[model samples]
Target: MIENRNEFLSKIAKQLGRPQPTSRPERNFSFSPQHQVLANATQEELVDALVEQCKNIHTKAITTTTADLVATLKQVVTDYKATSVITSTDQRFADFGVLPLITEHWPQQEVATHQWQERCGQDNITFAERADVGIMVSEMTLAESGTAVLFSDKDKGRSISFLPQNSIILIPKSTIVPRMTQAATTISAMIERGEQVASCVNFITGPSNSADIEMILVVGVHGPIKMAYIIIEDQ
Candidate 1:
């Protein structure tokens, strides 16, 4: 086990033929570009920014209250005309009243839905690839870029969002932040606290588009052709 940072710094210092400094330097910047971007914005402003950014990226964004979450979800499911759907085992689905919609309500509406299970193995990827829409809850959202931050694990298969033809992400209003800077700070804090960060942290902004050839654009080349975000006013 390592006792302290001295050994680590000493090795680097020795390589450079210098002694390791005993103290660290202080940051005395007059301003931080990261925080300055949306420093004075309120939650409402951030939400508005997120919605507008979604439109700019060709993603459908809807805002609704918790009471209407189920209805809004149903509408999105129907609008997407999803015959079969797959979702991660993320408990936010149930916590946000989405599990019953997929499990109980979807069947009533003749829509088949499956939740990812480790025991299912490759079955999860197969279903997700064939499914019409994939659904996930954003752990954090970047308003400036209209991006959804997802932490994928065993129960939360990354394919749930990648393989589907279309994607619909649920975003709680309270999770909305200024931009990626805030998102980075969140992950950094988690690391400093010795929390186990997932191996996969997906930052998705709109649908997949490729402009590789002749600078021309082709949507859905790598991922979903269509994407939507249902923002819940949970806070």
Candidate 2:
């Protein structure tokens, strides 16, 4: 019985002409589009144009000094009557000065952990929900688009970002990449260096939400109602 079955399968294979598979061709599947329009732009002109375009995205941006970032954050919390702020444990944020503010509310809390999700969600969801603003340090910035790139890692958990009602990102001007091509190049370099990119790499343009309901506009449906970016001078 086994021999007959094997013979039958061999005959079918011989009749079917089973061919060996070959490797796929290397094609350019990159995000960069080789268009003439982008090729003609100077770095300064590109950054300026990108910044202007981003401003019109309905998001707020402020040119900030390191000093201003701390002061503004303090002021916003005070104005909103917010005593607590949820932030990542990333070393960069140490200099941004978010710890003291957070400590005021959760006195014993020195670091933000994922476990806060449940408590934060149950407590009106506004504390850190659509009203809870999370301030984070970005991995890089696209100068041509004035966009911030966020990568999820141990220090900066993914939940801290999406869970908040508003997200305030702090990026330095010097880390800005000129174009999408340059951004992709940086990504490729990271991959080559054996560094595993975060599970989620969010490219935040502005606040979330869609106006497709009746063609009217609405914000903060799926994400934060507001997104504020602090572009600090590259020093």
* Candidate number achieving the greatest TM-score relative to the actual structure: 1
Tell me the lDDT of model 1 at 213: 98
What would you estimate as the lDDT of candidate 1?
0.91
Residue pairs with colliding backbones in model 1 are none
What shift in Å separates residue 4 of candidate 1 from its native position after superposition?
42
* Cα lDDT for residue 69, candidate 1: 92
Residue range with the least summed lDDT across 10 consecutive positions in model 2: 109-118
Residues 195-227 of candidate 2 have per-residue lDDT tens digits of 898878887767776879898778777776777
- How well is each residue in 24-84 modelled by candidate 1, as lDDT tens digits? 8788998778888877999999999999998788899999998899999888878988999
| lDDT of predicted model 2 | 0.64
Pairing residues by index, what is the TM-score of model 2?
Answer: 0.67
Error of 1 at 88 (Å): 1.0
Over all chains combined, what TM-score does candidate 1 have? 0.86
